[model samples]
Target: MTDAPQTNAPEPPPRHIESAALLQGAREIVIEHAGQCYRLLVTKNDKLILQK
Candidate 1:
C-alpha cells in the first residue's frame, strides 16, 4: 500500500460579505447596535468608515 502526500494548506473561514452583495449599486448602510444608530459608509477612496 502507498500513502498519499500531505498538504500544508489550511481552510479559510466562511464569510458572508462579497463583491456582488456590497458593490452592486450600494454605497452605505445603517446598523443598529446597543440601541444606537451607526452609519457604515464607503468613502470615495474605497475605504470603510463607521460613524454614529
Candidate 2:
C-alpha cells in the first residue's frame, strides 16, 4: 500500500482595524463604489448599518 502526499498551502492572515479609527469621531461616513454612493452609519444602539 502507498500513501498519498499532502500539498496543502497556508492561508494569509486577515487584516483588522478598530471601528473608532475608521470612523474618526464621525457618526457616519460615505463610501463610493462603482459610481454609486453608500453610507456607513453608527446607530443609537452602537451598531453599524450600511445603506445605498
Candidate 3:
C-alpha cells in the first residue's frame, strides 16, 4: 500500500469591518443569537464591550 502525498495550502485572511459601520453613529447596538440578546457598547474611552 502507498500513502497519498500531502500538500500545504495558505489560509485566507480574515474579514474586517469598521466599528462605525456596525454601530452606525450609535453608542450601543443589540445582537440576537440563540434566543438571547447581547449588547455591544462603545465607552467614553472609545473601546468596545460586549454584554449579555
Candidate 4:
C-alpha cells in the first residue's frame, strides 16, 4: 500500500430532488366542481409542485 494525498471537499448528492417523493408532503388543495369537492394531495420542491 502506498500513501496518497487526499483533498477535503464536499460532494453533492445525485438526483437532489425526486418527483415521486413530492406526493408525500405537507400541503393542502381545494377543488370544486358542480356538486363535488376534491382535495388534492401534493408536495413541492422549493417552488415546484408535484401534484396539481
Candidate 5:
C-alpha cells in the first residue's frame, strides 16, 4: 500500500582479517574520481605519505 520500498537488515562488521576471503583494516578513506588507486602511509608526527 505504501510507496516506500522494503529493505533488509544491515550486515555486521567482519571479525577476522587473517582470512583471505575477507578484507579489514580500513581507516580514513579518500576516493579519487580519476580512476586511480592510492595507498596512504602515516607517521607518528601526523605526517601523510604515499605508500607503495
Candidate 6:
C-alpha cells in the first residue's frame, strides 16, 4: 500500500493596529458601511463590541 502525500493550507496575512491611535481616549467609534451606521465600542473589560 502507498501512503498519501500531506498538504497544508496557506496562512493568512498578519494584521496590526494600535488601538490607542484609533480610539484616542474615545469609548466608541462610528463606522459607516453600506449607507448604514454602526458603533464599535470598547467595554470596561477592555473588550470590543460592535452594534448597528
Q: What is the overall TM-score of model 5 with all chains considered together?
A: 0.27
* Candidate 5 lDDT over residue span 1-52, tens digit each: 6788867979898776442222234433443446876665445675556643
Worst 10 residues of 1 by lDDT: 16-25
Q: Model 2 misses residue 15 by how many Å?
A: 1.6
How far out, in Å, is residue 2 in model 6?
43
Stretches of model 2 off by over 4 angstroms after superposition: 1-11
TM-score for each model: 0.54, 0.68, 0.70, 0.29, 0.27, 0.62
Tell me the tens digit of each residue's lDDT in model 4 across 1-52.
9978887887877766454454355465555778777665543444543232
Deviation from native of the Cα of residue 9 in model 5, angstroms: 51
Q: What tens digits encode model 3's per-residue C-alpha lDDT throughout 1-52?
A: 9999876877779889998999999999999999999999999999999999
Write the number of the candidate with greater lDDT, choosing between 2 and 6: 2
Query: What tens digits encode model 2's per-residue C-alpha lDDT throughout 1-52?
Result: 9899876978779879898998999999998999999999999999999999
Worst 10 residues of 4 by lDDT: 43-52
Pick by lDDT: which candidate is best? 3
lDDT of 2 at 26: 100
lDDT scores of the candidates, listed in order? 0.82, 0.94, 0.95, 0.55, 0.51, 0.90
- What is the Cα-based lDDT of residue 32 in candidate 2? 94
Rate residue 7 of model 5 by lDDT: 78
The best-first sequence of candidates by lDDT reads: 3, 2, 6, 1, 4, 5
Off by over 4 Å in 1: 1-16, 19-24
What is the C-alpha lDDT profile of model 6 across 1-52, one tens digit per residue? 9999876977778878887877899999998999999998999999999999
Tens digit of per-residue lDDT, candidate 1, span 1-52: 9999988999788887874476566788877899999987889998888899
Off by over 4 Å in 5: 1-30
Pitting candidate 1 against candidate 2, the one with the higher lDDT is 2
Of 3 and 5, the candidate ahead on lDDT is 3
Candidate with the greatest TM-score versus the true structure: 3
